[model samples]
Target: MMNRLKAALAASAVMLAPVFAAPALAETELIFNSYLPPHDELYQIAIRDFAAAIEKESAGGIKVTIPDTSLAPSDRQYEMVRDGIADMAIVSTGGVPQLVTLNKIGDLPFNSPSARAASIALWETYNTYFLPFDEFKGVKVLSTNVLPGRQILSVGKLQAKTVADLKGAKLWSPPGALSEAVKKLGAVPVNSEFTDLQEYVTKGTVDAMVMAPNSAKGARVLEYVTGMTQIPGGLGSLSFAVFISQERWDALSPEEQQAIQRAADGLPARTGAAADEVLAKLAPEMAKVPTENLEGAQLDEFTTLLQARIDEWKERAAKKGLSDPDEVLTFYRDVLAREAKASGS
Candidate 1:
């Protein structure tokens, strides 16, 4: 069934192929490495849907080979591209903080309302302020994308009613800004991947966890996480940097580059769509379990607390020689507002 689905997807891609202004004779092959498993929809769509578009747009001259692996995780994907271990890979900067501080702006709590707004702002930031090429010496970024925001998940009884309620709780979180946020909430932050969530929750090693609405479904952790709070409006919005080895990027013909860029145009939109789809698809089942939607003053307090963290991030950025921090932040805010207004957010 999966193969048939992939085949059908590939056919659709070829049908929507774009015609280039000028045709070239040279052909190129690029390896597209991902940390996601094959069964995951995001990985499949990227490999099958996006790759098909590339092949079609290049008129069959440019081929992208996607290898499925969890061994080379997202944190290592940047290094893989930098050192040429892999030609190209998708990475989340939030996974490694010290090395990529600038990228964390996308992960600031409550700065963005949804993945679409965040993704658009992220592209603008990367292009205008934090140019990926300038920051990472040996690789070129082909695309940037945003994931959905994280939610606070707990077992048996809910404890995240007030900021004070989070005190003394053992909470599991991925490494990066969110971990820091957990610390602020007075929860002990345990560094664990989403895959470990169910085990940790079931065994009482972790009383709560921060996860994307979709990730619980992908990792099958929803079975253990019965309560969820919308405490992280922007914490889930991670900017994914897709890098191609400079050597590989340089080797490609101009035609291939054009084809690749054309293929990458709507990556942010697609990623955001995937996130929304996950929420919409999962909401029904999630409703079967007990869930309370936080809004009004409660939601406002969460956003305010999260915004304080954003201020700290800006100060950190300034210390790192990103002069005009306010300008960069203002630009981000403005972009968010513009996109939100356009989308009726």
Candidate 2:
């Protein structure tokens, strides 16, 4: 009778085993390294929103943490993720040109008129053509985006009425194609990190800078600038890539991977929209600073000058072994055109 009771107790314990079983996996936490401050719209939309989406989609299986301090410099973000110093980061393609060459396609002059079109076109191009290049070998790319149209912001009495007015001006330029374009347009391009721009401007080292309106606003450029010169189709746009370390990416289960990707879907479009919002509000933000919108003959002349620079870019790209450089340019242009029309911009 005791043996019968013992057997019955063991059966009951087995029947209740499912209620106390442990989970199949532990929760995952990822570190997101960012150079931009939390208040920056791009940072909020791209990093903060992305983190929230990942957490929700993973259903508590994953959590992304963005520390209050930056883990690496803006230009070194790609290297930081590759070396495992950070799990994920947003890097400018132009910042690490040696590693991210194909992104130069978006850097071409007059590629797109607005950030919305440029961002969508850039993402589509990256997935369709640039993905196979091994440029981003150490990381898994989440999304790619472009800044709003580049404009000329001059400091303390420098005003640009035409492309010719840019000649002899000491213009601040970030590295890569934009710097080259600045030189081609006869300005003395001062290649420097964006962080040092304020100091440079305050010290009277640069007469002007080529940047997007939102970027200028974030940098508080109006404090040093007297006015802005806006160009049709913009001078050019910069490309940005969000990515995760390959090791961390590979460790994630297929379901986790899909979840993260789903959360990242349409991120480029969202970022573009955020940029448009910023652009729309710039007038009030810069109420004290004068602004000019180039038109008619001046606009046509600027377009011609940009075309020359575009030709140079194609030649340089061909030399770098990008087969059919013209084809790549044409593809990007067509994508931008389609996107702009679809968005009614």
Candidate 3:
């Protein structure tokens, strides 16, 4: 999972020789690293489309080029950008916990019903509360989006309607808080990137997974099991931030910087919408997989077990220098609810 290309470190600004076409194309060229697969719509809208928009907004004064392959692995993206191996890319907050603890507070279970709203809410919360702390000190954050909540999928059945059903079960969990949540609830956790989930499930290394419903299709794990229990928001979620090396952002002319910011506006919603679209497309098939609706006492019980997640999160947030972390969490939820209602999503 750590496999990364050794690309030459780039300078703060990679202004390339302008094309000799009838109209001069660019004075500034930014290398936007592509990490996820071609089918990933977030990359399409946030990276590729944003690049084109910035070029137009700047009247071709800025150009962004994507390499055929990524300069670094997904987990290595932020480090690469901060060290100047790439100009811009989306960094995963959950994947790099130490560098981005505060952002994960907004990812508590049952966060938002709509990806677009959750994403917009997450960014608003970040800009207001976390920015002054410089959580991501070396890179210039453009925008952020949290992925849709993951379903609690068991291998071949939906027996997870009760906490007892999960006891001693080997469940694949995203590392950090989610893993802690799984353990606190009595399930044995197998920690790894969801990209490798298929191998584990197929090899019988784990009996269940906490992941986005679309991963059943994307990771080719749809045929393996039939049980599904979606946790509101997500069982846990990953947050992504589009960022450019601070040096690169600082090097841009005032006009060029504004052009890029204009193009970056609403990126969180745009990426979140793309993610929702993919989830909606696969939802029907997911519905066919036997699911147990969580309600009544069962829901209450589950929530009780999840108190540890909240308690643990608050401690982490306070330790990170955030005052009144609980208020911050409430602020995120209020914003999410309002945005979701306004958008009718």
Candidate with maximal TM-score: 3
After superposition, the stretches of candidate 1 with alpha carbons farther than 4 Å from their true spots are 1-26, 68-71, 232-236, 295-297, 300-304
Cα deviation at 258, candidate 3, in Å, is: 0.3
Please report how far candidate 2 places residue 181 from its true position, in Å: 1.5
For residues 92-143, could you state the per-residue lDDT of candidate 2 as single tens digits?
8877867766776777777757777888888887887777776888899999
lDDT of 1: 0.74
TM-score of each: 0.85, 0.86, 0.90
User: What overall lDDT, based on C-alpha atoms, would model 3 receive against the true structure?
Assistant: 0.82
Give per-candidate clash totals. Answer: 3, 0, 2
Q: Which candidate is the best by lDDT?
A: 2
Candidate 2, superposed: residue stretches over 4 Å from native: 1-26, 285-290, 319-321
With a 3 Å backbone cut-off (N, CA, C), the pairs that clash in candidate 2 are: none
**Model 3 Cα shift for residue 127 (angstroms):** 0.8
Give candidate 3's total backbone clashes: 2
Q: Which lDDT tens digits does candidate 1 get at residues 280-337? A: 7887778876555667887776666667678888888887789887899889878888
Could you arrange the candidates by TM-score from highest to lowest?
A: 3, 2, 1
Off by over 4 Å in 3: 1-21, 193-195
List the lowest-lDDT window of 10 residues for candidate 3: 4-13
Q: If ranked by lDDT, best first, what sequence of candidates would result?
A: 2, 3, 1
